[model samples]
Target: MSQDPSTEVVARELRGNILLVMINNPPVNALGVAVRCGIVAAIDAADADPAVQAVLIIGTGRNFIAGADIREFGKPPLPPSLPDVCNRIEACSKPVVAAIHGAALGGGLEIALAAHYRLAATDVKLGLPEVQLGLMPGAGGTQRTPRLIGAKAALDLMLSGRHMGAEEAHALGLVDRLGHSNDILADGLAYTQELLATHAPVRRTRDAQALSDRQANRASIEAVRAETGKKSRGLFSPLKIVEAVEAALDKSFDEGLRIERELFLQCLDSAQRAGLIHAFFAEREVLKAPETRNTKPRAIAHVGVVGGGTMGAGIAVAVLDAGLSVTMIERDEAALARGHAHIEKVYNGLIAKGRMTTDAKAANLARFVGSTSYDALAPADIVIEAVFEDMAVKQAVFAELDRVCKPGAVLATNTSYLDIDVIAASISRPADVVGLHFFSPANIMKLLEIVVPAKVSADVVATAFELAKKLHKVPVRAGVCDGFIGNRILAAYRMAADYMMEDGASPYQIDQAVRDFGYPMGPFQVSDLAGGDIGWATRKRKAATRDPRARYVQIADRICERGWFGQKTGRGYYLYPEGARTGTPDPEIEAIIDAERARAGITPRSFTNEEIMRRYMAAMINEGANVVHQRIALRPLDVDVTFLYGYGFPRHRGGPMKYADTLGLPKVLADIREFAKEDPLFWQPSPLLVELVERGANFDSLNKSE
Candidate 1:
């Protein structure tokens, strides 16, 4: 340990003939300027010392180095850039060994790749994940990774931004040795001593012949390019990563390094990079709300899930996977059996795919219990009711939970649209009643909307957020409303699509435009997958209270009347022939749209893809602004995080609110004013948006003020 406080971040010690240099930057040991300069000075001193035969580099904390200091992003360049420090280490006379424990990512992985040898713990994850931030690695990662591993492997790792385990790294020759012990220093020192005894030559990754089969690798590179182009349609960084890796094989190492730096700078200058970075920060920011930040969460261990249907089963699986005991309650013995089968089916699928062993499945299932009576849930710390979506049904379930569950046990409803406040008011203990709205296929999706009712206590809300963290779900606090955050915004935008279809655009054209805008699928396609019947039901439910003067399109209802629900029914707006997953456009839907337009006495007009997106995004942003203005969402970033995680709002655009801020709120308000001439009711700009535009402020201003 260093006695001097100034030099404490990087400490050096001599262990016999080998020099041990450990980076002491806490948390993730990010590669800031100070750490970079410290490593450079330490390496220079190690080379000058006559007694030191080799050098071993490791981190003092959990991670070797996670990445660059993100706080320095979008700032002026500092002295001793990461690439410069990497070059200095690579050119050192003595062999430098990198001992990676937790993560070696981005600039961290680049530093490791530049070392003479690499050793990693068995659970360590290594990657160049800069593409996730809309930038390729700049510190010679593109040039050095391909030289250590083949060109195809390096391109895949960089493009997908996926982490590789230590065993996989060793198999790919990226890590020279795999350490079994948790002590990274001991394993690294043993390897260093063995290398010195064997008189092993210093292995420079830049001089390696890993990419010898350039022609054969070119085919795979082309395949990956086509795949990335399809998957990452509107993104800039993945393609840039492909270019950088291709240069690695086709050009000299120094030339490849130059190309990587140039492409990385280009990504940095792009707007997509800004949006992605905002998205990265906004996810963490959404959890810092006042309700949950200061309050301590109630302890929760055992979870009770009511219902064994799709959503209920998925929630059960999620809780069980989080290492909490689960008790599933159903109404009867047959229903309990069905729920048990549903849980078993999920594990059985994983077993058939060789993703899980029989023992692991058995162990996971052992933590799960199924009962037909609600009395079995008496011991649960939290009980979530995933019953039907009707108000009466949810009320009855909560009443039963109130009677059977223990005092202080959290009682939650998973209703997507029904008013949670009504459900809370029906129960005697309203403080325990909150909404834990998990999206469809809850185990797979990451978003969890925590709906806070007027009667719910602060600690209960805090407990829900704590449970979200335990389940590895992104929890967004939402005030109790019809659809809360995601579904409410979704309803607004879907209506916009409907109005566009009646006015000018075809459903297929609108969907195609949305896909072009960066979403994996368009609104109509998502409707088809989720079953068109769901929207039909919501429309029918609201028809009794809907404003008569408000323009309402009946095309979807007309289709639902014909029993063409969606993928499950084999027919919808699109056709899914022979049980196929993807759908083809149906002419009948166009006829229905035309008939609806004729009934409304409207002339059809042509809408370009750009126009469609303008209208689509305007409605989304307008509704998101309302969500923030109404305090349904605590801040604008909360709305952004909700959509980014739940809905297929593209991460590259940084969700609707962030995208609106990037486009300038004044421009968005202007677009809304322009559209209001056609339909005054729907296109009326949000008051907060109009107020912000007049005050020369932005939605981010609201985020910061909150």
Candidate 2:
């Protein structure tokens, strides 16, 4: 082994006739400028050495190299760009072998592709995931990947940005050998020695014949373009990826490299790229809570779930999937049996769809037990009540949990919009009570709003975050409020849509406009999927407290009065015929909207899609600002993350707050003030928004201050 402090990022040592190059950048070995230069220097030294017959490359820590250094994003270009380094490695005179473990993604995978041969551990992951950041791989990945694998296969890997395991990569010819040893260096050295003994020639991927026949793959390439066009919607990178792949098949290697570079630069300069990068950072930032930063989380082995309805069964499944034993309690024997049946039906559906094996379902079910008695929860490390949303029901459940749960057991409530503080106070051990608001279909949704009450301890908050991590969920800390962050904001924007419907715009038009903004479904479409009865119940609960002077749209209530409760009833805003999941526009909804507008003594005015989106976004941003101002949310990014995960906020626009920041705060404030002229009650600008605009700052400034 050789030691050199100057080139510590990329260390080198010679083993027999093999030159071993190890990238020593810690924490995933991100390819920064220093690491890129070091790799180039190491390869140059190996090529110049007379005794070296083969070169082996690997990473020092847990990962080979995850991707480019995100810290370098939006900065000035540095010398020896990644493309230059990759080309240098590919042009080496001696045979080069790359031994990868952990994740070799984006530029890391691009560098590996430049090598003559690739070997990986059985547990390794390899991918070109740059498209997720709104950019395709720039460093010859577009040109070289299709040459190793066909254009269709390369497009599938690049466009989806999904990581492929070693077994799959080996099947696809990306990896030549799989090592079973944990000692990657030893395995790499052995592979290198075998290659030297066999006298393997320096095979360049640039010379591969995988993509030489452009005529043969033209149909496949066009099909990819059409599919990506629909799937990507407002995204700019997926189409660029298609163009680059087409270049690989139709043009020479250098020509394709030129086109790829052009397309990559276009993606880098796009607004979508900036938004996606913000989203990527914001997701990581929401986890850094000041209260939980240094606190030690309590260990949880067994969990107790109260309730066995849809939400309860989903929660139990999520817990059991995380390898925790769960005891689910219901009100009676029949209810408990139904809950057990609901959970079993879920797994059986998965098994039927080939998503789960029979043995896996049996093992998961083994961790789950159903009972009607609260006494079974005595051994639980934590207890979560997923019962009815009513205050009385939640309080009674918590009281029972307080009586039966072991001391120090954390008590949590899965209330979406109730006052969690009151619930905590209802319990004997208020300090151990927290609110864990899991979105609908809890096992599938990523967002878990961790509502911390006034008396909860810091360690309990830390434990909630730890639990979220175990369940593969994103946790955002929220203070007690009527709707917390996501639902609070959701309530505001949903009202705005209702107002728009009464004014003139149809629900279908509003949905199409929001869809054009890149959401998978608009607000009404979401209501249909989730069932409108859920919203109807919430409205009925809040009807007594609603301000008399505020504008109320009764069109939705009119629909629900007829028992048209959305997908469940085959009718809501749109009609679902014959139990179909999708719904078409219904003329009856137009009549209800017109009747509501006439009854309110208001004249309807036509609204352009552009105006509709502006009003909708303004409403969302105004409430998001209030969420931060009231301290219901820790930071602006928390609000962003909640919407991004819970609701279908377009990730390419960042979260709503990030999108507001991209649009200047002053502009957003001006829009709110203008809209206030028509309805001052609903369009009132948030004090935080006004303060931010007056001080010439933005939501991101609040995130930084925190």
lDDT of 1 by residue, 667-695 (tens): 88999999999899989899989899999
Once model 2 is optimally superposed onto the true structure by TM-score, how far is the C-alpha of residue 700 displaced, in angstroms?
Answer: 1.1
lDDT of 2 by residue, 1-706 (tens): 4545667899888888888898988899999988988888888888888988889999988999999998899999898999999999999999999999999999999999999999999878889998888999999999998898888889999999999999888888888899979988888889888888888899999988887677767877999999999888889999999999998888899999999999999999999998899889989999998778889988899999999999999999899889999999999999999999988988898899999899998999999888888999999988999998899999999889989989889999999999988998987789999989999898889999999999998888898999999999999999898899999999999999999998889999999999998788989989988878888999999999999989888888999899988898898999999998989999998998889889988799999999999999999999999999999998999999998999989998999999999988898899999999999999999999999988888899888888
Clashes of each: 0, 0
Models 1 onward score TM values of 0.97, 0.98
TM-score (C-alpha, index-matched) for candidate 2? 0.98
